[model samples]
Target: MDNLSQYIDWFRHSSSYINAHRKKVFVVLLTGETIAHENFSHIVHDITLLHSLGVKLVLVHGARPQINAALSGAGQELRYHKGLRITDTDSLQIIKQTIGAMAIDIEAQFSMGLANSPMHGADIKVSRGNFITARPLGIIEGVDYALTGVVRKVNAEAILQHLDKNSIVLVSNLGYSPTGEVFNLSAEDVATEVAMAMQAEKLILFVPQRGVMGKDGQLISTLSPVQADLLLKELAQDESVARNITLESLSAAVKASNKNVHRCHLISFADNGALIQELFTREGNGTLVSKDNFEWLRQATINDVGGILELIAPLEAAGILVHRSRELLEAEIDYFKVIEMEGMIIACAAIYPLDEESGEIACIAIHKNYQESGRGDHLMRALEKEARKQGLTKVIVLTTQTAHWFMERGFEPIAISDLPAKKQQMYNYQRKSKAFIKTLR
Candidate 1:
């Protein structure tokens, strides 16, 4: 396909995301390194596009690298305790100057409006103020952190008012005390606190790398809060890993997830258009820390045969699924996985290895009451995950009544002859089920 054709197709596919994000609140974090990178302009453009699409944005920026540079240039000693910067009187002054300058630069970037550029004709409004209230860290281990502080509260009402007026609220790492004292706060902490206070739909952190990587050197695309906590503990044991940015980013994601922020995304700031790609595309280009733990998907055992039967009985009676006896289900229980909610099986699917490189998915059924709530898609993903664990490269499904559903999910129609040899032989000639195949990545 030509570039224009691909762009047209992508635009068509992104319509759903566009509608979903409209009018939703998002809190975005930009670190000092991110703003200094060449791709900063592109990131700013994407943020502009999102604002144009009716997304209310709260931008929290950090000046860690810039502050460090300024302090070093000033012939000052840098001190840190337990991964938190120890900001003395002089360091606090330098931090305020550095953060002040960075915030102005970011606002200026948002004010760009050059013809022929992405921001052309986009008269965006940016608002910044003392939106965060902070308290001092006091002392730990008999050492005073001085001006280093933590977020005590966020002025969410003021931020929302600015958003209602169609302005993007810009926040800095500097917070103020009721006593009129300025305190240096961690950018990640500020971002998390703001997200929780605002109850944002998403808390997006622009990091240096693509996303969180496992010990195997591969990016983990999605994680639950429990899983993220486990990964955090595992990453903390390795002293070679930089604990400042990456760990803090992941830790912030976890904190937001636990505090009613539904989703937290960590994407690379160096990659141009990553913010747009992650938000608008189905296969997001980053790690998604989501709080979707209401239902559990697990491999089925013999004890779950009754629940599976109960869940699929209606489908079987309606000629949508092949009926299986309890004996047969118990025997093949190891090949099944189920979605259970509150000790009840709401969905179930089975993957049977038909060849060395292919698996057949069957008996996919969801409770009628839960059919419209994405349980089917959840079960399908579980089946695909099981197929990958078995080293299968392809998955086939035979559907007499749900061919359209499978086709909509990336499966393509195929003739019976295209099925694996064993599956072809076992195909019920009377049922005349249509075959569809999908190649796994």
Candidate 2:
């Protein structure tokens, strides 16, 4: 019992690697089918948490359900064509109001952040634009689109300028065509166009039910575009694919990736901190799609730092990783675990025992060339196993970069004094060096 107590205590108290990496900017598509009050709260929490990170976010919201509800309440019937909504004259009017509610509701919720965690932080910039250009789908199989439209082009440079100035640009799926005609676009289309134009690091779509699965509320962590294309083929053949939000979203993501967006992520609005989970954790609370399965983690040996250093040099040069002298790595030689593919170490992490029963992971990183594979999670699980072997029950981390990551893995934050004595003595709380902890019990 004493041993168990000691183990649990250690698991709760060890610190995390705080200064691991720099902010990886991303554009997020926030859309959903369920428009309940509960979801509104989650939107607020997600924004506040991501804003806490230096992440540059562009929020695009979906309000089709809201618009439908409003229109229906006014005794108007909804129109559709080939699973796409037919936004005629009346629907167009409701779209503006429905989208306005989403933007306004989110803005009001942002103001509710804790005073210390203020909504109006120096980096907290949120704005919405009327910048979606659209063209009528013309006629599909003899069905006229009416006022329904497809996104023709996005003024992504405008959004990027706002992003460079540290603002969150909110987009509503409405646009005006070049011919002086107004049209409505799918939220998914709007997100994809913006991602392509920005050539974003990541493009994420937040939808309901996690991923494209029949199971209730399941989240798929990884998929390549080819795999997604095949699954979408199956979905297209079967109408029973009612829950396949993943496939529904793949069209735009594939287009964006083909246009040079590095990655695409589809997450649930249901997960409490889905945004953070997808962004920071190695195993995301969402489905990540890329052209291929890229490897980012490997088993580490004391000798791999030279190889690891080669991988991180660019990040250091980019001012993402704090430069360290060779002696510093040698002094903490036993702490690294690396990822190897083709017999070459591509990623590494530095893990150490904070005390007799406590472990701390530091300098956790992936080779940029090998990122987006599930290798990071594999490395973390290996680290967890090593901690268990050493009889440490608690693990803590200091992360200026991955707070949402640690949080998703069940790590919570407390004051530095909450750590075990030896670990606390090592704490270096920089503006970017936030803290986290996880238990093994």
Candidate 3:
């Protein structure tokens, strides 16, 4: 019964994403390495699930590893110039053959309808064609990238038509020129260009790593494009690190975001259900790149009451926060500050001014998942800034719990008598909450 309840709660939360994602176009880039991973079948199943859920998918796949194997099998040297495959005549043929085989395998996966599996009853139709036009990269630094090319145009109308007919559009890392020649292209380039031309809602890139890790070795959940660019520069300057899949995906996501894709994601291909978790959940398991802020502190609006209530309800039930009634919250909504992430409030606090020089911070709470990230301190800082704006010199907190948290933030313990007259009169002796105060500099 408890497991069932958890499922219901998760479904309730995911409904918002379902509603928002329906009929939206998402371009997903899969590298040769990702497609060959042990979890690839599960990833394909998840893709099928997304297609069934009304997400218009444009899957772009690469074949570098396959191409290298094919080249080695034929006794041809695998070559690269500046991190890009130098596609000579032999390499070009190998690239085409490798990409063709990958496309077939992906399409076959999408066509699966086995019973007793996630793909059961899924009648997904996949469409593939000459949807990309290319131009050669030309000679650079005396190195001619013979058959390697870059995207010049995307057949957005054709792809949209297939999407309108509810078909999953599959694009390979190969493009054609008007001169009737095929050119080797990067899958990331294809995906990013298609997404930009189609104005796709998201560009998702699968990588081996979970996501971009900060210097502290923690996954940075969200990054602005500007921030991503800086990280890319830093990575470029660091010689100890070899060029890897993560950097490639980050470059693609940054490119897509700069082209106004708005939202780009980098998720682990090895992690089962990562695609669903990244797309449907608030505070996703992977890294999100966006033009707009994914999480922000803002003054609360009437519409935020429900999210704030949901955030603090657990604390109230645990007797850590004072329970707030909806009616009272509605009346004092303007006094609340909330940290909202992807439309859900994760932390919140409200201030009730006791006198012109002082205010009492009330209902301070941070969701359990966010507490270890120092969001509580962030909320307090925001509230302190707000209090200063309101000409309050002192901020007070009454707590049965979290007194230590307040103390660590420079708050000093105080007697109940030190509180304002009205606050002292209304203090609950039965609750036995302690008082702590901080004076503004």
Best by lDDT: 1
lDDT of each: 0.90, 0.70, 0.87
Candidate 1 lDDT over residue span 1-441, tens digit each = 699999999999999999999999999999887898899999999999999999999999998889989999999998999878899999888898888888888889989999999999889999998899999999999989999999999999999999999999999999999999999999999999999899999999988778988888898999876678889999988665344477789999988876668899999988988899999998999899985765688999888999999988888998999999999999899999998765778789999899999999999987764564466888888888888988999999999999999999999999999888999888999998999999998
Candidate 2 worst ten-residue window by lDDT: 13-22
**What would you estimate as the lDDT of candidate 1?**
0.90
Ranking of all candidate structures by their lDDT, best first: 1, 3, 2
Model 3 regions lying over 4 Å from their true place: 238-243, 294-441
Better of 1 and 3 by TM-score: 1
Give per-residue CA lDDT, model 2, range 1-441, as digits (tens).
Answer: 999997776544422211221244567776646335366576666666665655567777777667778989878888887778887887777777777777787676655645554344433557777678898988889989888888888887788778777677888778888898888788888888787777777898766656556334445567666566656676676554335455667766766654568789877777677766566556667777785444334446567768777777776786556676677776776777776644466667767888887788777677654454455677788898889988999888877767887787788896777878886776655534666888888
Residue 101, candidate 2: alpha-carbon lDDT: 74
Best by TM-score: 1
Stretches of candidate 2 above 4 Å error? 1-24, 34-37, 114-123, 214-219, 238-244, 292-441
Clashing pairs counted in every model? 0, 23, 0
TM-score against truth, every candidate: 0.68, 0.59, 0.66
Can you rank all candidates by TM-score, best first?
Answer: 1, 3, 2
User: Cα RMSD for candidate 1?
Assistant: 16.2
Model 2 — TM-score against the truth? Answer: 0.59
